[model samples]
Target: MKLSKPLIIGIAGGSGSGKTSVTNSIYEVFKEHSVVVIEQDFYYKDQSHLDFEERLLTNYDHPLAFDNKLLISHLRKLLVRQSVEKPIYDYTLHTRSEKSVLIEPKDVIILEGILVLEDEALRNLMDIKLFVDTDADLRIIRRILRDINERGRSIESVVEQYLSVVRPMHNQFIEPTKRYADIIIPEGGHNEVAIDLMVTKIKTILENGTELYYDDDINQ
Candidate 1:
């Protein structure tokens, strides 16, 4: 079966703003449609080279921390109807695993991360851009839980990182990027209606074929 067009959708939010959850919801709806996920988290420079405190201080929220150039290059390939093996990242060790994920050109690619929309070059590749808006307090709580249990962080360290880095960085870079979003979804993954709306958009795109012809358009 020929994939008429590869719809690249970007989901952006601050730390623990449910970016991944929203992404998963989209995937649930469109899983059988042959969609691939390319996460921005995979681009973090290997932090394993550093010590524990140094890795904690490592600004995961910074746009400069990501390999945006490489991400843009991959998106370009996907846009031209090519497949890309996005890197896999592990937060537990603060480094990326050696193995690469092979992703085929599909009907849709749901790209999710904190700074997915931070770069104009990367943003331009998306057919739709969504910003997940959740309260700062709620985000912080989620961050604490995920970091402590999932990412192997301590309570004190999490608080310190939040106050010293995450909050400020979000205000400076991540939050400001919301203005660029084509749509803003409040409450993140819990917003089932919003998720449905996005799924509907993808269905509409497939039916319309207005943006799916990767072979025909160079600028798309």
Candidate 2:
């Protein structure tokens, strides 16, 4: 069944804070339904014009690093059930790829990113705003492992980048957006109770065709 209006869920947190884990949990619960995930990483600004060294200078954790204007525009089209050619970013090249993926509109859209809720325009588009509150130590550990194993980065570089960019950016931008969230999930995906509650809430909206405001006391 098609929804009268798409449900947009914004999941935000610090780098390696289990935002992807939380997103996967929600997507798994509604996979049979018309659901799609839009990653903020895909919207990183193109650095093709810059030299390799200049691209290396990019502070990725900062809000300015994202191509939010393009992201916002694409999201608006999806909200109206229009398909968009989503940009693809190449991590190895430190810039956007030449190709784009065509994304059809869905009943549910999960916007996952470190800075998803940082911008007012983006936050306003979300039906449910979530902040995954994971500890610094755990996040750093996760970041180190993912960068080393998946991105082929050295542990030293990962640690240095986290210390010089990620940690400070989280404090200055990401953490403050928690105040705007409808639900603050502690321990990220490890918080089963919170994830269940969130799933239930989404199901209710889908079934009843109405918006339900979550109680502040239920945030764990």
Candidate 3:
């Protein structure tokens, strides 16, 4: 059944938190239906004007690093059931790629990012907000491995960046947004009980089109 309005779920967490795992869990359950995952990292500001060295100096974990105005516009279009050409970010170049992927409107839109809930406008657009609460040690370890293996970063560089930027930014920006979340998911995707309950809630909304409510128990 088609929803009267698409359900927008905002999943936010620290860089190494299992936000992707949580997003993928939800998407896998609804893959047969109309659902799409939009990553906030895909909206990083274009740095073509800057030289390679200058681009490398970018504080990626900061909120100002994103082109949220364009992201918000695109999200608005999707909310109206219009297609949008979503930007693709290039990690190697530290800027947005020229290529973009066209995304059609879906019944459920999962907006996942390190700071998806940081902006008031972005948070206002979400029907449900989730904060994945993973310990700092685990997060850093995961980040180091992911960056070295997937993003082609050196272990020394990853640790340096995490200590200098990621940790401070998380404390100042990302962690505070937890107060705005409808649910606080500890251990992220590893928490099977939370994921199962979240899936059930989404299915209920899709089937009934009922008003969404924040469950205090879910956060406990």
Candidate 4:
């Protein structure tokens, strides 16, 4: 089927702010059709050459940690109805996987990550930019849990990283980018009202061949 210009949506938030949850909610809504979600995490520069210990020391929360050039190129390709080989990242290994996921052109694309909003070229491509805001304490708690369960991090290491880099980088980069968001969804995906309004906007984009402007009164 002929697709309209792909609606590029970006979800940006600090680690553990439920960016994934909000992205997943949108994906679930469009899972039956031509919609694909790509993660900024997948674009982390390959660190396979570094030893595990050296990779561990890397400040991953910083913008320099990602291969934004590749991400931008892929997004441009997807925008032009071309397919892209999306990189697969290994969180456990702290490197890119040998294999990649081949993504076909879709009507909607969701990009989720901590630093996605920091790049002007990337943010320019997004038709809708969403910022997920959760309390710092809640975010820290979620980060600890995810690092432990999903990434095999020890409690001590999680806390150390949070203090040494994550929190500082979040304050320096992620938190400030909130002002750029077209919509700010407090409490992340738990805010059903916000999610519903986002869905409503997506449906409108699909129905009409145009993008919707961000309105301050969306969820109010």
TM-score for each predicted model, relative to the true structure: 0.90, 0.92, 0.93, 0.93
Q: Please report, in order, the local distance difference test score of every candidate based on alpha carbons.
A: 0.84, 0.89, 0.90, 0.90
Q: What is the C-alpha RMSD of each candidate to the true structure, in Å?
A: 3.0, 5.7, 5.5, 5.7
Q: Tell me the tens digit of each residue's lDDT in model 1 across 1-220.
A: 2345578899999888898899999898778877888889998876667886686667788888888877877877876668887888888777778888887777788888898888987886788999999999999999899889888879998998889888999999999999999999999989999999998989999778765544444444
Say which prediction, candidate 1 or candidate 4, comes out ahead on TM-score.
Answer: 4
Instruction: List, residue by residue over 98-201, the lDDT tens digit for candidate 2.
Output: 99999999888999999999999899778999999999999999988888888778988898888888889999999999998999999988999999999999
TM-score of 4: 0.93
Scored against the true structure, residue 56 in model 4 reaches a CA lDDT of 85
Worst 10 residues of 4 by lDDT: 211-220
What's the C-alpha lDDT at position 117 in model 3? 92
Worst 10 residues of 2 by lDDT: 211-220
Instruction: Summarize candidate 4's per-residue lDDT along 94-151 as a digit string, tens digits.
Output: 9999999999999899999999999998998899999999999999999999999999
Give lDDT tens digits, candidate 3, residues 148-186: 888878998898999899999999999999999999999
Scored by Cα lDDT, where does model 1 land? 0.84
In each prediction, how many residue pairs overlap at the backbone (N, C-alpha, C within less than 3 A)?
Answer: 1, 0, 0, 0
